[model samples]
Target: MRTRIITAIVALAIFVPFVIKGGIPLTILISLLGVIAVGELLFMKKRLLVSFEALVSFVAVVVTILPNSFWRLLPAPAFLNPRTLIYLFIFLLLLTTVLSNNKLSFDDAGALSLGVLYIGFGFHFFLQARAENWMAFVFGLIIVWLTDSFAYIIGRKLGKHKLIPKISPNKTWEGSIGGTAVATIVAIIFAESTHFATHFSLFEIVLATLVLSIAGQFGDLIESALKRYFGVKDSGTLLPGHGGILDRFDSMLIVMPIIVLIGLTA
Candidate 1:
């Protein structure tokens, strides 16, 4: 518990400044995080499958998160476009499967592809969300943190019924409800106190927050499922009590994409 609190403080001290700056520095930070997350995922996979998966994930991160302007500046061929890169990677994976004498199964190929899309693509949207509006990004982070914290506290105090004992045994229905409620309240307070109130209608804000809060919980469950499948206790031990970059930012990965989509439509 003490290690967790100290790690949280040190992490915030480093992360908050980059989030506030919101430019190349933030991009670099997020890109590094994406790469580290991909590395962690590769480590979780079977040893024989790690090499190509790492390569694909690294390339995906580079293509997905780098600004379009950066791509434009490069004197690369048209085939180097992001979509083309993805297609080429898929083709290579299929070809490798055919040639490797059954060493790499379709399941391995699928896992690699899923890892690249899920982690790399998700972090791409995270960068886009922060670039769209730093305040909204901050608000989304607040919602996730508040929801998780309140849920844990409420669950410890009053939880009775299990939410999903298979995927996340510690979570309870009472905690889930308490977390969502706290997230909604925080959203309302944020909206009322900030300039966001002037831009978005009350209905829009409420709807968005409700979706984000639920999505955050689903994200947590998904990560828990991944850990169970991998037969690991935590994603990694890089952050002491925080597990890994993925563990620390799992909810953000899901929330940021939804937030970006909401911003686009609004």
Candidate 2:
């Protein structure tokens, strides 16, 4: 518990200032995170066969970091959106179906493409959120962090029923409910008190908080599921007691994008 608290504090110390500064620094920060995530995915897969896939991943990251001009020279936006993902998968299928001499299978290509979308596009939202509204983006982040922290503490003390024992044994229904409730309350208080979110109504803030809290837990569960699927404990051991960068920011993975969408519509 002490270790997790300390880690959280240290992470906030770095993340707050970094996210607050909305510029190339933030882009680099997220790009570096994307790189770390890619490394972890490769580590998990154990074989990044098909050199073109590696090139495409690099291009995706570059398109994410650099402006549209770099990617516009080629057609790369197809990989970022969901509707076009099927086409990209089909292209990969053809590539692996013919290019490989049984060195790569359809399953391998599908998983690799999925990883790229998951990590690559996920990190892009960090850039997107920062660019949209740093204040609301920061607010959304606090909502998730508070939700996860309070949920875990409350759940540990009062959790009764298992939420999803298969994906995350530590999770509980009570904890999930507690976390969302606390997060909603915090969002209301923050919205009422803070002048930064004056543009949003209190009701909207509450709704966003509820969505973010539930999605944040799913984000954590998603990471836990991935780890369980691979039979690995943590994504990486970069943090002391927090496991890895992914473990720390798993909830952020879900929250940031939602925040971006909200900011866009709001």
**Which candidate tops TM-score?**
1
lDDT of each: 0.81, 0.72
lDDT of 1 by residue, 92-183 (tens): 76676788765766777777677777876678878777777767877788889999999999999999999999999999999999999999
* Candidate 1 residue spans exceeding 4 A from truth: 48-50, 72-75, 197-199, 264-266
Q: What is the TM-score of each candidate against the true structure?
A: 0.92, 0.82
Worst lDDT window (10 residues) for model 1? 46-55
Candidate 2 least-lDDT 10 residues: 62-71
**Per-residue lDDT tens digits of candidate 2, residues 76-160?**
5556643354356547645864688656666666766666667665677766776766666667777787888888899999998
Q: RMSD for each model, in Å, please?
A: 2.0, 4.0
